[model samples]
Target chain A: MAKSGHRTPRTALTCALSLAHGLPIGWCVLPITHFPFLLVSSAYNGCKRIHKEGKVMTFRSLYHTEVINDAGLNGHARVTLGGDFDVLTSSPLQDDPGTNPEQLLGLALATCLNATIEAEEGRRGLEHAAEVKVGVDMGKDTEGYQFFLDCQVRIPQVAEAEAQEILAKCERRCPVAKIVGSSQNVRVHLVKQFAF
Target chain B: MAKSGHRTPRTALTCALSLAHGLPIGWCVLPITHFPFLLVSSAYNGCKRIHKEGKVMTFRSLYHTEVINDAGLNGHARVTLGGDFDVLTSSPLQDDPGTNPEQLLGLALATCLNATIEAEEGRRGLEHAAEVKVGVDMGKDTEGYQFFLDCQVRIPQVAEAEAQEILAKCERRCPVAKIVGSSQNVRVHLVKQFAF
Candidate 1:
């Protein structure tokens, strides 16, 4: 038996100072790096080529989503994933195992919302506690699927008038929320093989 | 030269149904997918290789931050980016080339305050806008450099009474914000060269 021979490449950082009002502020930068491949003993008693490009590997993953309730018009809603009643799996096949689309969509939507809210909040000067509740409704057309997102946010502390102004600004500025609420078409291809 | 190939893989989809108290709920299941690979035409004779595990192909990606600035913090109150001045020759790097970190921090603090006020205003089931602002103070350390983060959040429609509770919940929920605020032991090694 031999070792797995796992290695992780690291980076060296370089720093300089930028002047601000006659004061020096620090600036940090990391340079791009390259690594050489080496050969040692292998479990198969052979030398194998190791790819050293500093890139995260792409995996072929899949996801299955089933919207229990569309919340067609009413404001309140709930959605579930997995178990029976799976809309993504019609014909049962050995190769067909559902990927976690619910989790992925949730993650993507959450990250996007986080970015949008942060950007908008940065533009305004208000510090307090904030919470966002995102609700997604999926619809279908001749093309594929469309997601309707309704986000409700709770900000604790501040005057009524100021909150309205910030809310308007956030609606216009948050990219992810805007994308979900926009008229731009998002295409989801139905494929036997899954790729991003 | 051979033409590049764009192959559309086959996608399979299925659906199932269940009744909750005689109400039918639907679910959709789809296959697992791989993360998309970048196509740098010149890299591999007009083709690109899939990034290996743990490697990131893209150099610059968006990061979410939440910053907080208490009132009466003078001088250092302003938030700016790209080194206060053009001291760092690398201008127009991304979003705001002339962004001041200090100014950004100040604005983030203000935004957090504003969100709370707004959330309070959007009473009666209306959705209010919410946001978080992040400011990082990067400086040289004995080992390398350190980044001090300040998080400010604003929820446009929160009542004053509920402010503390909401803020605490948000602190725990936001993923990127949580990682930065709680995780202080993240480490990275700097290697001059790789020999294995």
Candidate 2:
């Protein structure tokens, strides 16, 4: 784990390798035994301590990832920072034993949707029963290839209309959803069960 | 692989488990012993044979995946369909030995950008050497949590201004980039090297 020991907002720690872009500075921490040392600056100046906990805080980023790929889709991708999350990627249509962008996109969407819905379920005093499955299709557009994602969401204990309401709220709340939902190729549907 | 045989356009293949949503039928294939069977329909009827290859083909989805998570971020996530891509997920701020949305998002963006850049380099007859790193930060918003993604691209042997031009084109060609770059929270920058 590359994360510095998380402290209260007043004594918070961040990833020690922020940047040195000669901009306004912020402090991030490196995990050093029981002591976290802050020693980096970054181009991003959006480091706001608005963390609503203590009056002061000093964590610029909660978690950090550094993924490097040389040969693109036909090569290897490894996370150089934090925990090791490495993968070999290829075209989804190939017979290779590696993952493609479609699967990754689908996994991210499904995980994020259900995770966000799980929080909502907890808030409503319900069980964590929401399931999300994203089917990512690689299609071509006017320019080149495009992605068409079909997300089927199932909240078993909830009514259909109410489930739709929850899905809408989660869409607004989920970070991944917010980032990817900006495109017209993505669709979210409420289903009783994912049609496998 | 759940993918059908990738025959020519006249014999194209798709994921056999399309859907039974009672719509205009599209032919998807199940991986058979060198032979594929076409079956299933889906809610999406946009299955166009615009693949511009053979005169005709009969594959709907090139690849398919099913992911399920019951306990959300605190539980396990697994791909139910195709090859298993499973992981334990948790809050990025926690000490648990697992991954979170931030890392997944970074991997997807990094892999897709580098892969797409590789294609561009191949087209330009340049060496396949483009590195991409995405730094995903989780922060709080007025409503809930949000993500700030900082993607740094480095293309060795290419000039900076021309590299930026390549990134702009790749942004249009890469499916993941088109999906996630919609948000204002995502930024794409040209860096000489990742400051690890």
Candidate 3:
């Protein structure tokens, strides 16, 4: 990681100021051309590819969310990114047309895992249709609230053994799965319905 | 916790079968009425409250997501819960209409933290207007991809010191904050706009 050791004193100062002002430390902008000596490594290959396009690449992501009125019970969250996404804290049994944290986590996990699997298939020159279902359970124990995740990946037209191998690789490569699984427990299942 | 040690042989068998079948191990439904000897503790208060409505409660949330095409560049995900959400891997510099994982994590974190704050205020019998903004940064390091979170909370009509006190308590109680903060580094800032 050449980038890890390439932090200049000016960048350190900027980060300190940002922290003091309660701003994002990673939001500090610097012209990449000025640091021509900084070597790109395979670890940051994605970022390096983006930077090679004459663009100053910063991997930082910014997010904004506002809760409407009160919180919990009847309140809703209006999340603004490219559009407004409404999130509700209502239970799934409430017959409400709103989303929850568990749903969002499930979505993130499922999508990331599927993306990894698709990438693996592409690398292997294999084509298959795949779908993922994620189930998240939120509960409390002596250690306070915790999350249990169940992920099932169905890939038709692929051999069951091959699908299992691909899914295992995806589980190891998926970023969201790594994050959540490292922090908590996540169970992954690979199902092959029929062979084409 | 009594429930920790109350796993009956039947429940254990069911869990083993479910695991073998690639089903959710926690989805085993057992009638609570039959387990009168299992003592409820403070750790299970929240679960007990939800279960006291004379309904069998299962804290399971299921989600489905499909990858429309390949992974990474030019790829999109269709996530379906109660509603359909389209997520893209569009860069922030692009004027694209798509949501990303960072935004979703920010929404979940902001909402959960605000809910904890509201609950804390309710317990204290305090009424005040509050708003929270959560900023999450996704980047790569020597340890691979990671997240950095910055949360700023504004509470109106409350003393600065008192609001800080309450916000600190909220930080301690918020589940999402705990999950993320414990895993990574999270910076929390409590800002008081005006003196009331």
Candidate 4:
């Protein structure tokens, strides 16, 4: 075991070197590099698929997500992207044109809201036991895009005002909701479009 | 505009041709097929970086995302693989070693519970505004491995009995929770590791 002591140049170097080599921290704390078999044996193997196509492109986007609470429960709602732009698709569903990116974005936002509720309930030390319903509204124009997500959550024996506070907190904590609410410019490289 | 009937064939043929010619989706969609121009516009710039790296590897991962509802409000929750077994780091957190995967898996189960809530809420017209919370538990015993996810949802102004029934129904609807709840084998492969 390495003893706790004053900071030393040697220790810093060791830490840096270990990190640089992608070595596990456990092995780094103890000097055992000479044992090739042990080092090799300890390595964890995992495959990662890399995308090779597409130039890194800088673009502006806003992601919208929502949460809904109703029927004595809470739920979620959402939409993503900075502006309301339809995903140009030739497919048409009956009289209605096939779903657009906006529509898909709606679904994504709904999911994000649901995720928020689950995370928050856990934070509150509550067991996972409830149902949710979600809805989203996207208002787009030259002024920009505004996404409103509403949800109804089903829980046992909670007052209306208390439930409202919980839903508000959930919105505040939701990562996806926060990202979109902040309206930060997300940097994403346009990758190859998947052929349908 | 081209008639709807002809669009599918043309799009498929065009995609096939683009692949054969090593052209990116951006080029395929463009009216002009000049190679240089095509490469520049494709999403992710035609995977050039991916090509520069030699060898190919595959990474299999499942992300569990969920939405939660309490009453007329909504929230969201999710647990990811990175949260649990982040083996890429040189210094692994001493609190938990290799079992991070189990926590992440537990998070997935919890997220599935959120999904169940969302689905159930959708089924019941009462779902409106909602909030959600989640909890995850993971442990290993002589039997093998065990993962448990618990969620708590808040629904304002709803009866307790109704909330319990919805929770039961939602539990049945969650897919990720069910899969993780079942026995399955998980494996990982090692690709080239790089130091930051």
Candidate 5:
């Protein structure tokens, strides 16, 4: 693949950032990047496009979240957008009384996969009975410390093949999954019961 | 690149998982993946290879965390390993009173980068004065609903060039940064002050 083959098309990124910062789309001074996939696949408003002519663009985010961490691993992380949430972070190696990266990564994937599966269940008119568990291991590698995420999805009363299909779909559609799955360090398993 | 070029070499992954599960290295039934890089740079003991002769191995995870979610988006995510942590999960698109993928992803990066920067500060004998904030926007794209993460790093009492160097280092060293940064959809910025 050419270096240009994977440059993130800038359309949706520009649109989302502009709308989040309360700037008009046309007012964005960033260099225009024309990636057509971001142009065609976006159903945000199902409209033509974000015109650069200072016309009011219909682009907007379905959800926006902002968070800040000042204390690093031994400090607090709180929600600055969306809702009230805060977590105390500590290094697991120290046995400190707080969460750490491994925990956060696990929760991010577990919640994301289970939630996306729930949405899939809703569309199929099935009651939500799916469970997801993500296990993260932090260890030193040839390079440095790295993480490996092992995901297990369990959907009750569903046949194995169908559950696998749902898990596959969630792997594709869940945003967090899409992010982490891009790495080779992650895996998803279908299980009848969580090892925990 | 051949498809095998990117297959997750299984050395550290296997070692970590095996040690986590209390299984001996020789007893592991999984396929052996010999990624040479994982075989080399790992300073995890600066020792010899993991022999399959049922020998006692020195490999182990520095830290491990497991999390589970049963209720999906409208439920809860809690830690099952290391320390105790739990939080409500809700879809941001619904005005629900809880956390979601966006918040978790933000916290994951914010906490990871800031924590890693703190380590860097300690190494340089500087007081920890680094801060990180991540803003995530969720919108539909040609592919489907996607997330854009804008990371801002602020290092107080440091020159711009030096801080930029640190930020660039953290982008490469931080585990979460490595995972997410591999994608073109993410951007890291060094800023004088956070917009928020």
Candidate 6:
């Protein structure tokens, strides 16, 4: 174990060399002292540079789906961060009890939109309750198949103008919204309801 | 209740009028006769045309999320066709138990890929057990945040060449893959593992 008080000119030189050559450096610190080591791998350096520039943090998520039968239409999938979920297809004319891709997109958009609203409220230090409902419709047009999203947000305490402002912010800041909106000209209808 | 064997000129005229002017047609069958009425609305007319042309059937799904707290980060969401699921963000550096946008993307991709593979296999009349694992990584580049997907598909009882062919078909047909891939050049690495 390396001690923090042992960081002399030699230690600084070693750290610099490690960073320069793209190597991993490990440093051990004592209870009373703080020592920083340069585990400057190439990837680590890139991430560090990004962080130093005040960029958004990188996030990774994993998901696995095990097909239960020869028919791939049904499966069980679990996100490393989320619990297990089922995915299946159903006839448009029938009332089925399984999840489909359109539903996933709707769920994703609703949750992400709520998160964006929460983040804005947190920034403004406001305590207002809100609810979001997303309806996704799949249809075929000149561009084969496409989706339309209808998002209804109910804010009980915020005024209509302020709620509109918040929704505008979300439209610009929400990642899922940006991705889906820009892809294939998805028409998004926004309904803002003031319960108060 | 409409009766069958009532295919008179009046019934044909009614059907023609419904199809010509775009109306909602509801068909009913009686104990003694089965009568079909054309309740085809404008949208239903378009769908019927598409179906007559042998196009893919369209699917629609709805989702709702109610934010329980003033903070928008936590919420319960459910899909009309899918089961209930939770969506929440966690610190990027810590291993907290919450689902984020990235995880949802991964799950969606995995499920979509499996469904595509199943469609291809069904077309080819091949029966093989397959499982798919999708890993999505969100990183900041010069253009902001983008996603990278690594899909590992394990297929038993299929030859490598055939499996590759199936995967290629899936890559072309999977809607989620195409959407995410075309959005920002999402790098999708396909790995075929044979567990013989």
Candidate 3 residues lying further than 4 Å off, grouped into runs, are: A1-73, A80-93, A142-145, A155-165, A192-196, B1-94, B141-146, B160-165, B185-196
Residues B144-189 of candidate 5 have per-residue lDDT tens digits of 4666677889997799999988888877778788777765456677
* Local accuracy of candidate 6 as per-residue lDDT tens digits, A1-196: 1001101122333333334444433221122212123221122221211111112222221121121222354534554322333344432223444455555666666666677777777778877466667544443333223434445676556778888888777767666666665553243333454210
10 residues in a row with least lDDT, candidate 1 chain B: B82-91
TM-score of chain B of each: 0.32, 0.71, 0.53, 0.36, 0.69, 0.54
What's the TM-score of every candidate structure?
A: 0.23, 0.74, 0.56, 0.24, 0.73, 0.56
Worst 10 residues of 6 chain B by lDDT: B1-10
Error of 4 at A103 (Å): 2.7
Writing each residue's lDDT as its tens digit, candidate 3 over A1-196 gives: 0001111222344334225545444432335576564434111311211122232333333222222323553457655323555555544334445555555566666666676676777878887467777544554432234444556688765788888888877776665666565443355666453110
lDDT of 3 by residue, B22-47 (tens): 54443322345754443331113112
Cα displacement (angstroms), candidate 1, residue B48, comes to: 45
By lDDT, the better pick of 1 and 5 is 5
For model 2, the superposed segments whose C-alpha errors exceed 4 Å read A1-60, B1-62
lDDT of 2 by residue, A1-196 (tens): 3333222231222323334422222433223332232223242333522111112232354445555666688767766665666766776666667676777777777788788998899899998778888766665444456766767888889888879889999999897888887666676777776663
**In every candidate, how many clashes are there?**
95, 1, 0, 125, 4, 8
Model 5: residues with Cα > 4 Å off, grouped in runs: A1-59, B1-59, B142-144
Best by DockQ: 5
lDDT of 3 at B8: 19
- How do the residues A1-196 of candidate 1 rate in per-residue lDDT, one tens digit apiece? 0111121121121111112212222321211232122222111111111111232111111111112211111111111221121112100111232211211232233333334444445556655334443322232222222222233444444455655555555545432333233322221111122122
Model 4, A1-196: lDDT tens digits are: 1111111122333323345546442122223433323332111211111111111111111111111112121112111111111121221111222222222222333344444555566767876544443222222212222222233354433455655666666656443333233321111111122110
DockQ, structure candidate 1 = 0.02
Per-residue lDDT over B34-115 for candidate 1, one digit per residue giving the tens place of the 0 to 100 score: 3233422111221111122222121111111111111111111111111111111000112222222222222222232233
Q: Which candidate is the best by TM-score?
A: 2
- Which segments of model 1 are wrong by more than 4 Å? A1-103, A119-125, A184-196, B1-196
